[model samples]
Target: MKEVYITKISKFLPNRPISNDEMEDKLGIINGKASKGRRIVLRNNQIKTRYYALDDDGNVTHNNAQLAKEAIEQLFDENFTSSDIDLLSCGTSSPDQILPSHAAMVHGFLKCDNVEINSPSGACCSGMNALKFGFLSVKSGQTNNAIASGSERISSWMKGHIFENEIKHLQALEDNPILAFNKDFLRWMLSDGAGAFLLENEPNGETPLRIEWMEGYSYAHELEACMYAGGDKLENGFLKPWSEYKTSDWSEKSLFAIKQDVKLLSANILKKGVDSLKRALTKHDLKPSEIDYYLPHISSHFFKDKLYQEMVDNGVEIPWENWFMNLSKVGNVGSASIFLMLEELAHSGKLKKGQKILLSVPESSRFSYAYALLTVC
Candidate 1:
């Protein structure tokens, strides 16, 4: 098998940065009332600014596929174009449509020649899955070059009108007048963006990051859903999928809105993540001292200290100085977050040859985790 190198990295963060004060303006007030949980979520997430694909009028400016397409365009130059790509792998929790896969839609927009395409669906780990697929394809000599992307266009779903039906239903039942915290909180937490990575058999740029290895693990068998959309969780810990619900029940129950069991996430997310990291390190015979940079995909600053303590408890401590994170500036772009962080660090000019970088992503959807080791060459 051959080696795979990440020759280029790029990101598209949609329109201008939206500050905490401007978030509700972009996403709009739900049920014509301000959110009570917005400030708390923003404070915990510590996201100072983020981008959205919507204009001031709450109209979508770019769909999910377009965001991925724009990011992919940044990878091309006079030497390489879309036609040079042998495989396209895209991952997104919020695709523009349900029928056509995200990669298929992106390919239609690129207008490039036919090539192998893959669309991996999930939460944050979806992006890492796409990256892994591209890596294995190139390493196995199935393709000479590949483009992997992670993107989300969830702003449209978070708009105020999307929840009007649910608000009315709750009011009719004399239930809680506001949207549930599980669904309302996410409106302030997530933003829109896309990021892409160019992989090849040989390094193309002046400083290439070689993919040493990638590892992933899931605890779904032992855990129930922690974060979800297009469904509701039952008392028995089963997720009643959207397909089982009637059309009217969809909006009435806000089944499409992103929801999180905060208690469940707080309990297992970090512990499971650190456990997976330990296993990956053991499998690869690596040590914390060998890592020069640590890029962790944390959804909020709330988990920053907790994650550190978890690592310390597990005896795999990577000091704070070695960490690199852009969650404050970019918000949680979901699956695209890891790619966006890599794009920033790869172009930051701080990397040196032979320095090792570790990437970690934890998906609370079902307590899944992914880790990767890269070396600057």
Candidate 2:
């Protein structure tokens, strides 16, 4: 099979910096009197800011098409134009898309008539999934160059009319819709931002990084673990839904051959993923000692420790004390985390040639995605 190369990566984190401290202060004020039952522990600022496409009122943005345009511009700045792109994919949940795919809007706005474009929807993992899909398409001799990127204005997920009850319960949120429930999830644990990459069949010129390989699989049962509004009706191959009769505890759900508990889940999933990667390594004749760095799609600091323990439990060895770090400074950016890590590695000169890299995606309550990508030789 032919190989696909990742030519370059660009990230667009907004100028607005919302640190954990900032969020905590805002939350304390936002939920002051009524959020006694809602609990969240914030990072002592171990996490930092994330970008946003704000409205004129300095609030979270609702114009997704504009954000999409800005993301594309930021990704290819000082480099590409409409003429250079052949395939464009926009993986997003929010876009100025009422009638057409957001990618089509971008294509029309850029006035690039020759390129093929698509908009993929899968929520947080959408951008990463789009990238691997494009990689396979290229490797299968379908396209030569592709642009894969995504943006999330999670701010829009809020609805004023829907939260009237919650606001009524809380005195601090009399003026605004305070996200008390998600505060625990957001704490220093996550942030909001966007990033993109320009993938090519071959990299030349000033391209900072080159692709190696991208592989994926579906754990259907696992997919049924984490889900939302349209979770049960999942018909597309994109999502892993939470089981129809899912209960409160993570363990009660039948993993079948899989065990329960967060630790066991991490160990088991990591073991399976590493086994697949081991097969890939055997096919390529590589080893763990050969991998200089590891980039994991982390969702929580707790899982970070659990993952490390699982690596030891599964007997996978490596020197990753510094390798498996999270972007705690910026929070978790969903599917954008891995790509953002790739951008960071390349720009910081941490992603060197002939290096084997391992990236394990976090548990989405459904499935955990893992991959083994090698740096250009």
Candidate 3:
């Protein structure tokens, strides 16, 4: 069987680093005003600072395509041009336009011809989906060189007209304004960033990360609705069309309906994700003790203890000391998160040659999970 290796990783973060304090100020949240709830959510998420593709006045400076273009540009070397790329797989939760897919827009920006483009947009786990597509393309002898990229401009959308109107509507309707717009909580949790990885069928570069095994699982039927991106769910359980959402009054329904069932999400994510991880490990006949690092793309630090306990419950004691995260610095960049985390980890100079690493991404949008094992070579 042919193998695939990640030869390089490149990330691009915008200039602005929005701190919690800055976030509160931007939201006009005053002291002792929902302070307890704010503190709990922020502390639980373990997010101190996150980047935004915004200006000083909090206006969007860059969209998804531009961010992706910048990140992909960083992956190119003197010998590799846009023509060298056989496939471009881009995953993003928020895209610039509906017509031109994020991958196609990036392809246009790169001015490349004859390269295949795949833009898979949805929940946060699409990063792994993009990677899986590119990996299979190379592993199946269909392509020699491929680029898997993930980019997000979530901050701009979160702060856009729809959410702001929803916040106001909720505040007007409920006595406790802070808790009213509960679904808007993610506004403070997610930000902007983009990352890209160049994968080759052969070991073309020094210290390439070799892919050992990958697996995915989903438990979407476990919940009615947990997290969502487009269109509101109607009373009949069917999703409203985007055109209807655009044509109707915003007050009639939320443009982007999000129901983050904290209890359900927290309870099932770790269990489902750990089960998926165990299956991957077992398929490869590997054990927890063999992995030097466990890089998990958990959306919040609130799950840290639960995830650890879940692994222990499963009898696979991947120690907390062996695990590391960058969520505190980058927040959750949606589908771009795992790629951003991987970029920082790889460039930190902490990983060693021949060490085994496990990368897991658990997405709540559909209760989907993805797990991969990589060896530093």
Candidate 4:
């Protein structure tokens, strides 16, 4: 198998840091809510919240399609695009369409006829699975050069009615505000993001990273825990999903269930990840202690606990002391979690040659998907 290398990566976040305090003030979150662990806090205060970036014209710019284009454009500029890129993949949840796929949407923007595109919809695991497929494809010589971009549009998931219902519980207190600023954060913590990477086969020049090998395992039983049941937006964007006649039943079931679904799914996903890694490395007799860096999905703050527990159960030694949290600051970021982490590491100049990075992804629709080890060389 030919070695597939991650030659370059880039991330484009909306400028202007939105601090927790600022977010609370702007969104009207209060002391009781703040003290009740209602707000999502980032350990790194220097980290900024990411959002949809608008052009100077301020047009609520860049739907999912445009966002993909801008993200890829920045990545190409940062790493230098080549007309020779063999394959392009878009890993996304907010796909532009269910038919042609978001991969083709990005391909259309790039306007490259030479490359084949595939959009994978593995929910939050889109980034990991897409890149793993790219690496595996390159290893098999199907392509020498490839690009993977992971983008999420959590804004689309924000329904006004849902937001209103969630905030109604706050009792319209001007001083007592919403949790996590009492906006959409109360319903969901994951935010929006777009991250891209350029991968090549056999780096002929100076390179700091290479994808050594990758493998994934799937658990399909837990799909119900996280789901998007197709909102009421018509294709023409006319009728609202909930605009149909009101139902007769009027019961006050909690607007949201605090059931431990994400938490449970996190534990299950991490457990499967450990098993998959052990099985993959057992083929070459490697262990967790041999890894240099570990990058896993930051679904929620509790994810770290799940990872630690899984490592302990698997008897795997994790060399991570960095807490390595990103969920709250950028929200969940769905498919962009691992890829964005790599982009951040590259931005900070921390990714060095001869290091091993272990990546695992916990997804929504796809249950759990993970990668073993990708050596940097």
Candidate 5:
């Protein structure tokens, strides 16, 4: 197999850091029923600060494709240009437009006429799928140069905070405000960012990472309705388009609306994630003991212990210190998370040449998982 390597990695986050306190205030979460809901999310999730592409009044500042284009531009040097890229795979959950596809828009924005574009839309692990496409294309000699990128504009979701009247109604229905308004919590947890990787078939010199093996898995059938958007799963196991939902409930319908089964996610994410990684290691004939670093794209700190225990149960035995994360610093950038984590780790000056590293991404949406093994070179 032709070896593929990532020559450079870049990340773009909109605006400055916005603290949780600021978000709570700006979203109008005062001493109302939503206040307890906001407090629960802030106290449970370890995110102190996150980046948003929003103005002072909470209006969208940049669209999804623009954020992705900026990140890809940062990857280019004097020797690289849009024309040098033969393939562009864009992964995004928040697309600026649906008809043109985010990747195609990016290709046009970059003014590239000959690049093949593919947008792996949906779910958080969609970004890893985009990277896998680029890696496979280069490794197979189908394309010499490819860029895999993940970008999200989830701050747009924050603009549509649940109305005060609705919050009052939900609070009346349940004693726990968090449980009553679970979807509202996602707005606070997810953030806006873009991360990109430039892949080449041949390594000109020492690079950040050389792709060894990449594998992705999905158990959507088994964990159906665990996480979803665009539609809601009914009690009968059929997804009903939100447009068809009656009762004047605009609260459950929006371009950025997302529904999640928290019970299923908290129960299955770690076990399935660990299993997927173990399978990848076995397929590549790799040993967990040899991995120098483990980079994980996790949305919350609550899952850290669960994943650690899962890894221990699976016999990987990697210490907590070996796993690097940027969730607290960047929040959950959705599809862009893996690339952002990788970028942070590469620039942290901790990795050494010839060291082996593992990158893992687990998505609640569709219950998908991906693992990549790389060597610092």
Candidate 6:
């Protein structure tokens, strides 16, 4: 097998950064009432600024495909062009349309040569899945080069108008006037962005990140869904998909709104992550002490310390100094998060040759997790 190297990393954040105070103005208030959970959620997430594809008037300036296209474009140069791409893979949780795969839409916008394309669907792990696909393609000599991307245009989904119907329906039933914490909290926790990586058999750029190993695990067989959308959770924890619901109930129930089972997430997220990390470490015969940098995709500041304690308890602790995170600045871009974090670190001019970087991504959707080890060369 040929060695695969990440040649380049790029990211595209739509519009200007919207500060915390400006979020409500951009997303609007559901039923003309401020969200009681917004401030608390923001406080926990610690995201001070985030981007949106929407303009000042709440008009969409760029869709998910456009964002992915822009990020991929940054990977091209005088030596490499879109025509040189052998494969294109994209991953996202918020797609512009459901019928055409996200990669297909991105390819249409790219207008590149006829090439193989792949779209991996999931929550946060989707982006890492795309990267793993590209890595394997290049490593196995199936493709000379591959472009993988992760993006999200979730601001539009979180807009107040999308939940107005649900709020009215609930009010008419004499239930809570506002959305449940599960649905409403995410409005402030997520933002819009896209990130892409160029993978090739040969190294390029000043400091190439060689793919050492990648592994992923899903506990869905033993765990129920912790985060979901496009459906409702039944009493027994089974998800009723959008196809099973009537069209009228879609809006009335806010079936499309992203929701999370916070209690389940908090209880199992770190535990499962540590369990998966332990297995990966054992499989690769690696030690946490050997890692020079650890990039973890955490949705909130609330998990930073907890994750550390969990790792310590599991006897796989990587000290705080070895950690690198940008969540407080970029917000949570879901599937695009790990890509964005890696993009920043890759361009930060801080890496040294032979240093090892560990990437960790956990998806609360169904308690899935992905981990990758890279060596700076």
lDDT of 4 by residue, 307-348 (tens): 687777777757666334565456567787777777776566
- Separately for all candidates shown, the number of backbone clashes (residues 3 or more apart, or on different chains) is 0, 11, 0, 3, 0, 0
Report lDDT (CA) for all predictions. Answer: 0.94, 0.56, 0.79, 0.60, 0.80, 0.94
Against the true structure, candidate 3 reaches a TM-score of 0.91
Report the candidate with higher lDDT, 1 versus 3. Answer: 1
Q: Which 10 successive residues of model 2 have the least lDDT summed?
A: 251-260
Better TM-score candidate (4, 5): 5
Candidate 3, overall lDDT?
0.79
TM-score of each: 0.99, 0.74, 0.91, 0.75, 0.91, 0.99
Poorest lDDT segment (10 consecutive residues) of candidate 5? 247-256
TM-score of 5: 0.91
Worst 10 residues of 4 by lDDT: 248-257
lDDT of 2 by residue, 1-377 (tens): 55677777777665566654444343233324434322333333244554434433446553554555665665564566767787888776445544688778767766665788777765555776677777777777788778887666544333222334444544443555454333223323434466677777666445334557665554545444433322332335343334544443122221111111233344455555555555555666666677777787765554555556666675665656547554665566665677677777767754555666665554443554546465644
Measured on C-alpha atoms, candidate 4 has an lDDT of 0.60
Q: What lDDT score is found at residue 344 in candidate 3?
A: 83
**Best to worst by lDDT, what's the order?**
6, 1, 5, 3, 4, 2
**Better structure of 2 and 6 per TM-score:** 6
Task: Judging by TM-score, tell me the better candidate of 2 and 4.
Answer: 4
lDDT of the structure predicted as candidate 5: 0.80
Query: Once model 5 is optimally superposed onto the true structure by TM-score, how far is the C-alpha of residue 139 displaced, in angstroms?
Result: 0.9
Q: What does the lDDT read for residue 353 in candidate 3?
A: 94
TM-score winner between candidates 4 and 6: 6
Alpha carbon lDDT of residue 283, candidate 4? Answer: 73
